[model samples]
Structures are given as C-alpha cells and as structure tokens.
Target: MNSRHIYHVDLAPVLGSTFQPTGFPDVGAATFTRFEGGQKVDALLVESVQSMANRLEATAWDSAADRPVDAVAGLPWVRVVRAGSAEFLTSSRLEAHRLASPFVHKATVDGRPMLDVIKEKLGLAKDTPLNRSAMARAVAGLDPFCLVHGVFFSHKEWLGQPKFARASSAVIEAHDVLRAISGGRKSDRVRHQLGEDVGGTAEGYGSVPFHRTEWTAKRIVASFVVDGELLRSYGLPEPVADLLETLALWEIRVLLTGGLRLRTACDLDVVSEVEARRGPALPELDELTGRLRELIGQCGEVFGDGEPLTVEWSSGKKG
Candidate 1:
C-alpha cells in the first residue's frame, strides 16, 4: 500500500453564463458543452501554468494582508526632461488594476530602453520574485501588486513572438477565421459594473459604462502538479510528503469555497493520490488544514497567521 505521492486535483466548475477569461479573444480557447451523463470531459485549454501560479501567489499575499490586491502593476507617470530624456515619476501601486503596466521611459540607457533598468533593479530575472516582502506588507496592511505577484513583463511572450511565429498565409487565414468568429456574437445578458471615466467624458470626470458578457463554460477543470522529488529533497518530517499532497487538495477546496459566481465542486476523488475520505462533514480536512497552516507558517509564514486567505479561519470557525 504505497500511497504517498499525490499532487493534483481535478475540479469541475459549472458556469452560470459566458465567463470571460483573462486572455484576449484571439486565444479562441476550445470549449465543450452539453455532456451526456458520464461523457468524458477533457480539461479544455488550461490557463497557462503561470496564470495559476499568479493566482497562488496572489492568494497567499491577499490572505496574509486581508485586502484586495491586483497581480498586475499600473502605468507609470513620467515627465520629459530633455528631447530624448525623461524623469520618472511615481507609478501606480502594483495593486492597481492592469494587465501589463509598462512604464518604461522612451529614454535609453546604454542604447537600451529604461525599462531594462527597472527590470535589473528589481532583481527580476525571467520576470518575478520579492523575498520576505509579503510578510512585511501583511503587517503594514498596505496593498501592492509587486508585493503579491512580484513585478514582471506579462506581454513578454507577445514580444518574443518570432518572425516565423505565423506563416505568411497563416496570418491571413487566422485573421479571416477570427473575423468570422468575432462577428455575429450575442449574449442573453450583459454584466454591468459601475465604472468611471475620468479621462474621457463631457464633464471633467464622469462614470463610464462598464459591461462584459461572461463566457460561460459547462465545466472547467483545473489541475495542479505536485513535485514529489522536490518534497523529498527538503527531507521534511513524518509523512510531510503526504501532507503536501493533501494541502494541494485543500487549496482547491478553499478556492472553490470562495464566493466565485460559478458553481464548482472540489472533486476530491479526482485527487485519489492522497486517499482522502470525502464528505459534507470531514474533520480530517480541518485537521490537515491546521497542520499545513502550522507548517507553512513556520516556513515563510502563512498569510493571516497560519489561516486561509480573504475569508477568516480561527478556532475551527471562519470569521
């Protein structure tokens, strides 16, 4: 009975209506709908592994800080000093909403854009990381994206697209196909959220209409990979390997339990790697969570004092 290494869980999230992913329309992620009972549901188009990483990082930070923070940074405010030189001003707190905030000045340093200067300064290689910053921010109760997701160039892949990235004819075919699909799109309901347009309005500042039709999916399955070998390298305590596997399952359960608009099931059985007994009332979950809480806290410190994020958890009672 060698049941020790389990790393992933498959979750089936049922969407209410169309839910938009963070990616642009060009992605054209594959979708599956209307399944007959027990028809195999493939994990259609996983969000890039990095996306999940960001979610994890963001969750850890948010939990520790007990505040809403974005994983992306906002644009920087710069002022031109010379014809080709600019003085950098303050930028948006990394917590501000944005996908990629490239505040690099048009100015050059050693024939390179100033953005390079920032990248190097932050010790951001291959894009992100800030050690011990999260706990400091958590204590201060201040929110910032870099403190959470770490600073990185999100559009790096698009910039890295090679010359042969798209064949001469493939581009044309893609555009035609995309245009065809982009047209004739309709929605039964449009999601509306209050928004403001300080820059574009007849009045100096006014609210801008915000609307989006969520791209609903019949079910979304998220998979997490466990690094068994890495766990062994740490040479952690009794059945620590098993504990990590169990934690992965709990993390998924907690995320689903978050008030996401869609309905989702933790689908722990899909995670047979740990052999957890599933039920409405599973004290084992709390026990495992508490152990993980202590373990993670001992490591780099767990967000919000060895408890869960966003929502409160103390004395087996969520605050």
Candidate 2:
C-alpha cells in the first residue's frame, strides 16, 4: 500500500541555531500582514523554481535527428525573459500571470514580433496561419523560453495573481523570523580598515543600510499541504511525476545547502496516506534519485562517448 504520491510535507528551519535569518525587502523585516508575507514566500518559491529551471535547461528532443539535443537547442521549459509572465506552483496546480504585455505592440529581443521569430527559427512561412496554441507549442518545442520556467510544476491549485502571489494550498503557514547575525561593527570598520571619515563622519560603509543586513540572522521556513491524490490524478508517468516532485524539493535544496549563515530544514516531514501504516511517513530521497536515472539511461547515447555523469537533484533530511 505504498503510494509514491506525496500528499503533505512539513518543514521547520532552525535559524540562528544553525542557519541565519533570510528576509527580503519585498515583505519587509517586520511585516505582520499574512497576505504580504505569503506573497513574499510565494515569490521566493517561484523564483527558486526558475533558478532550478536555469540549472536544468538542458532537456529537449531534437525532432530533426530523432534524438535528444543540447541545452542550447531548447530548455526543459520556457522562461519569458524579464518582460514575460512568471509561473508559480501550488498544492494542486500551476498558475501564470502576465507581468506586462508590453510586447503586445512591440518587438521582443529583435526588430520583429515573437511569432515572426518563431516562424523564422522553425523555417515556417511568414504567412503560415500559426495560431496562438501552435505558436506556443512550437516555441516550447524549440526553445521553451516562452513557456515560463517551471510551468511543468503543475498539479497546484491552478491559481495566480498579477501583483500578489497565490500559494494557499501548498503553503499553509510560513515564518520569516529575524535574528542578530554576525558582521562588521561600525567601530571595527573605522578602527581597522577605513580609518576615520570614510563616510566623512567616521561611519564608513559599515553603517549603510541594505549594504549589510541589519538583522543578519533570518529564518524563512514554511509548512506545506500537498495532496498525493491530486498529484497522482495529473495522469503523468510515474517517473515524470516523481521527477517534478523531486525537482521542486531540489529547488529548496539548492537554496539552503549548508553555506553562509542561512540554515534550512534539510529533513522534510513527509506524510502520505499511501504508506499509511508506516511506509510513506519517511521515504528516502536516495530512492527517488535512483529513479531519475531512467531518464539518463535512456538518453546516454547523445551524451558524448565515455563521459562520466552524475545526475544529482540534491536536497536533504526528513522531519
């Protein structure tokens, strides 16, 4: 009765103890508004996925050669430059909101409309009736740039907003705790390095705001509610579903690796009704990593001859 579908996850970050605080200006250091704080956490999660996407941009099937292709050939998904909409994942689906459609009447990255660029790249006639769907799929097939990174992070609530983020289902609660971080004191700076009058007042750059984190120790952690039932309903292949879950977890792993003063919960509390009695409560990530290899094994041919490969979607621990 083991269901690989992940239903819920609980994570608690031990800041100051091991990891320092991690706060941002968007939500402010002392923001108490739930919505605003949620928005900030949502933004972080979304961008983190984009970061993962950037790291994993190399996955595409070359239709011409009937084989896998290079990263430059296409990304695993699209990332609409700065002006394009961004994507966010939730507990049940993926959602998107247009940042700004400035490209509506203007050209993007070139002196032509996006359709024209896609047409030229695909070697299609300018007059070809490339509808919106066709155009999107075409662009995704070739570059995935227009698809927005991590759009494949589906099975959330399918919710989105323009100025605010919507992560109701996935994130039940989030905490951004502040703490005293270690750093250069103004007196230390003036005495050792910049003798007096660095800032013309013996303050130097040590006392500047934003330049140094006032609250050096910050902890950002959240409790999530995932639904394996909903996740499994997406109808994707088992490996692919697991891959998405793995990558989503990997995004956190990448951001919270043991470094700097930012410590995070490496061990995530995983609870699934599938392994109800005792199984799903604590599943090993190593098992999932082993499964991701099927993808590599299937495409090792395109991977230049005699190259040692290590496909690591690294993250840690279980709470």
User: What lDDT does the true structure give each of the candidates?
Assistant: 0.32, 0.31
Superposed on all Cα atoms, model 1 deviates from the true structure by an RMSD in Å of 15.8
RMSD of each: 15.8, 13.4
* lDDT tens readout by residue for model 2, 37-143: 34642222311323223332222224454323442221232223333322211100111321112222122433344433433543444335424343333333432
Best by TM-score: 2
Off by over 4 Å in 1: 1-17, 25-43, 63-219, 234-250, 259-284, 293-319
Q: Per-residue lDDT of 63-84 in model 1, one digit per residue for the tens?
A: 4443322221111112212323
Clashes of each: 12, 20
Error of 1 at 231 (Å): 2.1
